[model samples]
Target: MRKIWTDGLALLGIALVLGGCATSKEDLLPHDHRTMLDIWNVETSGSAGGGPAARQLLDARQALRRPLTEADVQAAPSVQARYTRTAANEIHRQFHRLPNPDLLMYVFPHLAGSDPVPVPGYTTLFPLYQRVQYALPGERLEDY
Candidate 1:
């Protein structure tokens, strides 16, 4: 009995020690602190590696410094016209309307006024059309 108790206690102690060592360094940090550390590391290390990306960035900066020529100014309007969308086109682009079936509602003819004037019964009823249908996946309206 004595030997069994000692062996059990020894096993428990070994398990506790193993568990302590198994815990990761990241497990000790709070969630928000860990996220902040990750963001900080990315920002600090991102620009450290300089190569073709750096050269491309330098080229872009130089392009920005160059003065605009008369040809560039003349081409601006045509470029703008190609990209610019009208108000109606913009409205159509932003909103996605689903298709709904038309519903025809009939108003029953009834007497009106204190004099009880009889209203003529008519079959005329306006049919309410459903809103515009939206373009879904694989559905093309125009070049997006």
Candidate 2:
């Protein structure tokens, strides 16, 4: 009885799937066909192209607009320049890397491995910290 019920559901599911595929794309869509771009253009057409909502929005924006004074124009660059990341600002200012003092170590001449080989003495610099550290935002990283 269980096997018969399972088989009947499986047959019904297959029939439904086949029935869904029988309807052509043409029948499913509207009689007047339009491309996605055409639909988007119609939907997004602005005040000039003539939508009442768009006209109202444009009028509101125009009402909010104010003419910039000479002082305003002059100060604009200074305000933007403060936050602008240039080579000088990047190296010296806000995003400066935390100071990690390098240790100068002199390695004496030594012999190693199965076959003894003479290694010349040399000075190498290693940072005090294992990894490079960066300053947190608004943290004072200037040398005291």
Candidate 3:
């Protein structure tokens, strides 16, 4: 009984620690440049020199948010060019993005259940469990 009590306390502490790390919906919501850049490493590659232009746009975005009044909108001309190229590239990319054949089965884990959600329908969703949290019963926080 004493051993079980000790184990329970340990598991409770761990769950609290891990749950604190859960990603909130707020984190995934789009924000300004600083936040967007945190996840996406945007590059303007192959469009009037994408690398430098993209960086300049990033810098310009920072500058725009500051008190500085002298920032010319065209200060990052290369970035504009890159943006145009990127826009075109994006349209092209849409053609390349196709639905996977395996997705049909993946979506409908159980064929008998009231018709499963479409595969692509849930593509944008995230994983429910992390590898670190894959513990059984008393060994995990959920158990506690």
Candidate 4:
């Protein structure tokens, strides 16, 4: 019984030492004093204008301020067209849809019940275009 008790105590001591090592060393150190908001405020307050990130942001803003040349304006449409997407392209993407056209018809009065009853004339509507039509780039909204 004494031997069993000694062995148990030895096992417990080993477990305690291993458990201490299992904890991260970084966890033993003090936590950060500043919150996320504090960090963001410091970065955006312009007080750090000498920092590399601030200089880069200033350079980008200056580059954007440069006037666009005539050639650049002419090329803008092609660039916009390449990047732009039509309504039809968006609808047809990721889903399958059949082209169903709308039709308009007038139904004449008829009598075709078990006891021949008169039916009144009525008008019905359906889609004329089979597929969805998308507006062209730079097309006027008023035209649509």
**Best prediction by TM-score:** 2
Query: Measured by TM-score, how close is model 2 to the native structure?
Result: 0.41
Better of 2 and 3 by TM-score: 2
lDDT of 4 by residue, 65-130 (tens): 999999999999978765467775665443324345668899999997899999999999978775
C-alpha positional error of residue 91 in candidate 1 after TM-score superposition, expressed in Å: 18
For every candidate in turn, the CA RMSD to the true structure comes to: 14.4, 10.5, 23.4, 16.2
lDDT of 2: 0.79
Name model 4 segments beyond 4 Å from true: 1-29, 48-50, 64-67, 80-144
* Local error of candidate 3 at residue 74 (angstroms): 62
Ten-residue stretch with the least lDDT total in model 3: 96-105
lDDT of 1: 0.67
Q: Which runs in model 3 stand beyond 4 Å of their true positions?
A: 25-144
lDDT of 3 by residue, 1-144 (tens): 999999999999999989877967678774555544433444633334457767887788888787634455656675455446465566642222222223222343333447764433223343433322333222323222
Give the RMSD in angstroms, all C-alphas superposed, for model 1: 14.4
Q: For every model shown, what is its TM-score relative to the native structure?
A: 0.25, 0.41, 0.18, 0.31
- Candidate 4: deviation at residue 9, Å? 20
Candidate 1 on 5-56: residue-level lDDT in tens?
A: 9999999999999999999887896455446556644444444455566567
Considering every candidate listed, which one attains the maximal lDDT?
2
Winner of 1 and 2 under lDDT: 2
C-alpha lDDT of candidate 3 relative to the true structure = 0.53
Q: Could you tell which candidate, 1 or 3, scores higher by lDDT?
A: 1
